[model samples]
Target: MNLNLPFSDNLPTNKLSASFANTSATYKFYWLIAIIEIVEKGQVNIKKREIFSRMISNSWYTVNYFHVSFGKQDLIQNAVEDILKFESLTKDIKKENLLSILENSKKIETKKLLEHFNLNVPHWFLSPWFPKLKDENNSNYKKRIYSYSQNFENCCLYGLYDENIIVNPIWIPYLKSNSKILKDFCYWNLSLFLQSRNPNVPDIPNKLIKPAIRNGLTKQTNEYWKNVFKELGYVECIFTGTKLLFEEKNFAIDHFIPHAFVSHDLIWNLIPIERSKNFSKSDNLPIFEKHFEKFYDLQKVAFEINKHHNSKSRYMDEYLSIFPNIDSFEKEKFSNTIQPLITIASNNGFLYMNE
Candidate 1:
């Protein structure tokens, strides 16, 4: 008998949050969570991945919840057709395991799958469409599928919004002056911003993403902005709503002005925010949604303004138009605006940088 636990509350610690369902590990992890919940709640008859596979096979043909009832078949089938029609070598391969049959498994294959999907659909939509995945070593079969779906979905979203309409400007004097601070700033900013998407206490040093910051002038300005936020102490993320105590790292570098819509990357625009909340704002507008009742004190003022300005002043709509969503822009902006947000940085002993 399946234990009737509340859906969200029943989630396992090891699984990915609903927000991270687009990622492969998270997708598999979510099912893992469900399986664990069944065991923890005292159901001895639960079959594992095999049962999941059976569920997919049984559910695949049902049009009612095909996207959620089946797993990867719907989207992956399109990819399979593209491969069979285009790739000369794939013609001889059987249609059953086209994903596994493909060569150059990682980059080339993944990119091809992404291109075939052509964006627009959320990767999570595939959760019910695929078979229960087994643990495979060399191929990382599941992750590749998830990444492919996410990439395509993102591309579609960006294409529709014209999110990448403008490129970063070629110049910024502050980034040139403070490369060291800027580098550290960008590293931590991206790291913390990514935390909510992987809340299982991320193994620190997860190989930070390097923004294409090459010029000396641009590097300096980036540092100055980070320095300012560093001086202000700590601020909470407006989205994920996670607050780091003084014992924890209370501060992060955020972009005051995002580089996507605004051409410049400078330190003068960086700011500090709490880590968890940063995730809630993922590349979208940062204003609190109606659901954020807990942040009433912080949100009451901004929410009203967003309504008044048509979501322009202090609202993230302008930048979000070209990014993932308002929430997505908030996360990216929290990650990108490390240089200018410093102006709002507060000074207190709670935040201390070891010299």
Candidate 2:
């Protein structure tokens, strides 16, 4: 890492400022947050190879993914399609040409926008910046980004691969400077960037997305669930073996299938429990066999209570979605309802425990 590059006196020009300047919004956003996460972990130098892999990896903590449904697909492919769709929909990008190529991008092999990120999009969209660029020669993209960061004046990241990265001392402090007002500022932009479809324009500004920093996949809050759980006959903490009070904040909703595996919030996967047990289970899958019979009985009771009440029918709706084939709630076996969901959860990487 080159530690001694002289800092520039001027703030970044409009062309090189905060949003990375006409760069692919989808690509830039992921690159930005990945860098933010890496820096936050106290590592300044980065290997270029790590960037792509990190983009696709899942975190155990629930990501308040913007465009939650689209966000859940094969992560990398989704990002690539987002990049292509962004360019086509951007008014300033080779708008006509990109739209024309977008049709080609949907064909058999290219249907998923099906080529390596570096080799396909630029040339396909007639990208003025990267036409003819291939992954082997992809250093141009990184170098250009480094130049933009240098001009942006925050001086957060600088350096080429191999010799090592020279992270600016000001990097973290500058981005984190006013964090209280703009928490996870970069991460929100990444979500906006990823979620953006037909950009109202090709170059959406970073300022526009900053306000969404406080948003995410907020699930049912304890207060609402507390009321619902009482009706579900779950008036106690299953883990702590203590009675629950509606006014207390100690209650939590547990995902019978670990979220790392299922990444779902349907009422079917959730149950009320003590907060402490949730912490202990963390992202691990539970041994449902131990508690299945009791839970099945309780859920049926809860379903019947809510079935005739349309407003509360969500409880029934979610129950039915999980056990669609079973006509009689009383006759439904624990294995019948759970087996299918567990199969899906396992394929997505959930593990099972015999106990």
Candidate 3:
């Protein structure tokens, strides 16, 4: 049957799975990616109910405690709860709450109504597709999806996946079928489950799952930078004269301009700064004259090392966003390129940090 997955032929070629696959691996992750992979391979009109059935059954997992020093820790919980909340609403009803709550609400209380609005829920079906696409039939089908693990018996006592038990499948699909892709679906749903489900939670698409689930970037990036830092050598904290090693744990990938205003993690903006300074820098843009030269030199070293290691570090794309017209990092004058960015931030209420 056609899965109605968008980009039915164009899933992410390099990695079948989403980023953060290692720590957040789970059923939702796998199923979403799997749907995308299947669609990319040419499937359409996949039943929404069947998709949820697949999720509910295979959703079984352990208490997923992620070492979340970065990113949203509650992403999965919010996604899942929102899915269930919307699922509980009826088509005939006016969606009284536009935002609804799940019956199993105690597990993850969405403290605020905005929590409901902010949910990045996934679309399991296409309300409508191209004329050539097969028609969706919600007719009753056997709920065949189920899940279990070799070590559930040993770990179920404390894992969150076991608590993420979803029941009865029914809900609205977000976005139009024609407007979305399997990757979008995968990331939306999987990010929620992965972020929320600690251990034992299931996850990815078939083509992506086979390898994506097995490989990850957190460790890889850390390892890559570890080597780069070793090769490029070390530096002392600019704010504090304390000697800081360039090792992963010892430092953080800091956004000198503060991500709040710059809103990008281009390699030029990124630097290995002491963790203490990173926290202290918070959302303030640094005085460019004080740090640009150092960050510029460090970015070059980091970029060269990343290119040698992975050639296509994801950060490069963001880097290009800042320099949309330029391909190579060579031509742009550092101050000329960065000053425009600082001005943009200044206009947006971003304050400068002298330190």
Candidate 4:
């Protein structure tokens, strides 16, 4: 049936999928994109969530029908918490002003207080009113429509980030039906590979391998990188249907973009593909289409493999392209580390990073 979402009027009909497939696929689309933003960009900025919530509210049926697997949710929650912990370990923000802000919370004038502290927020977020588009029926409201379009576009272009790896291929149909092609493309990003769940550990699946790579959790071990992958999921390698039984599972947790090219080893640029394929793929650009095409139909493959549209690499390219002459290595380093941490830290507002 019709998903009576807020943006339904703006979008076309026939995109609705009343089935459970559509709901789950939509959630996966949202969750995956959000996770990628967090891992790569440092955080999914809270202000952007207001806009996301609006879009989601507009499409309630598509959202409610699909239930995210409990295992996926738990893993995501843990990852976010760990990153927040890392932020706390590195920086300190005093609670006095934060407490004062909470105590003096008034509904109307909080905007001024936020600005006084130099807090970055989108204008439309948390506000009661949303902008309306003008039809031929109303000439006076045209400017309002233009303003909303510009604001919404800006929010979408620069707002979201994250790197999530837990997805079931079963989501293919529902996403295909919605014709949210970009979302479908991202749902099974080839560059974002997953490990077979680990077998030795009961809760942890042996076959599963993490798609992203950063430094290990601690300074203690030599093989910390490998161990972290094992913990995350790296049970076996599936390369072009080669299920070869090796003496020891000779797999390497490689980056989607070779770390040699992109110094930052965040979640977006990682995957647990075969060591041989990783070697063959090397530092070259990610092969966006070939992997999943063999299994799914051509139409579904086309819908799911639009490289630049839904891919995080495209976002990174756009971000870097705007400031082409990034000469200062130190500035780059500081920007990389600080911006993401700050954005993530600000998420959930009062939930201290340490917690």
Q: Count residue pairs with overlapping backbones in model 1.
A: 63
| Candidate 2 lDDT, 1-355, residue by residue in tens | 1111122344222211334445453444444454555666677766433444344322101222211222344445464345434434431233235334543444443333323443422222222223233353545655554444444233324443332344556555643443332324445544455446423211223222223233222354432354455664446554456765556756666777655444446666666677777777665555566666655654555445445334344455555655653345644555576755555544434455432
User: Where is the poorest 10-residue window by lDDT in model 4?
Assistant: 198-207
Give the true-structure RMSD of model 2: 15.6
lDDT of 3 by residue, 123-178 (tens): 11111111122243322110101122112221111111211322111111211243
Candidate 4 ranges beyond 4 A from true positions: 1-238, 242-247, 292-355
Superposed by TM-score, candidate 1 places the C-alpha of residue 145 at a distance from the truth, in angstroms, of 37
Q: Which segments of candidate 2 are over 4 A away from where they belong?
A: 1-234, 308-312, 324-334, 343-355
lDDT of 4: 0.31
Question: Deviation in angstroms for 258 in model 1?
Answer: 6.5
Question: Which TM-score value belongs to model 2?
Answer: 0.40
Instruction: Go through the candidates in order and give the clash count of each.
Output: 63, 1, 30, 30
Q: Which candidate, 2 or 4, would have the higher TM-score against the true structure?
A: 2
Query: Per-residue alpha-carbon lDDT of model 1 for 79-163, expressed as tens digits?
Result: 4334444544322333224333442234564445644332423233333333244344324644544544334332211111111
Candidate 3 backbone overlaps, count: 30
Give the Cα error of residue 148 in candidate 2, in Å.
25
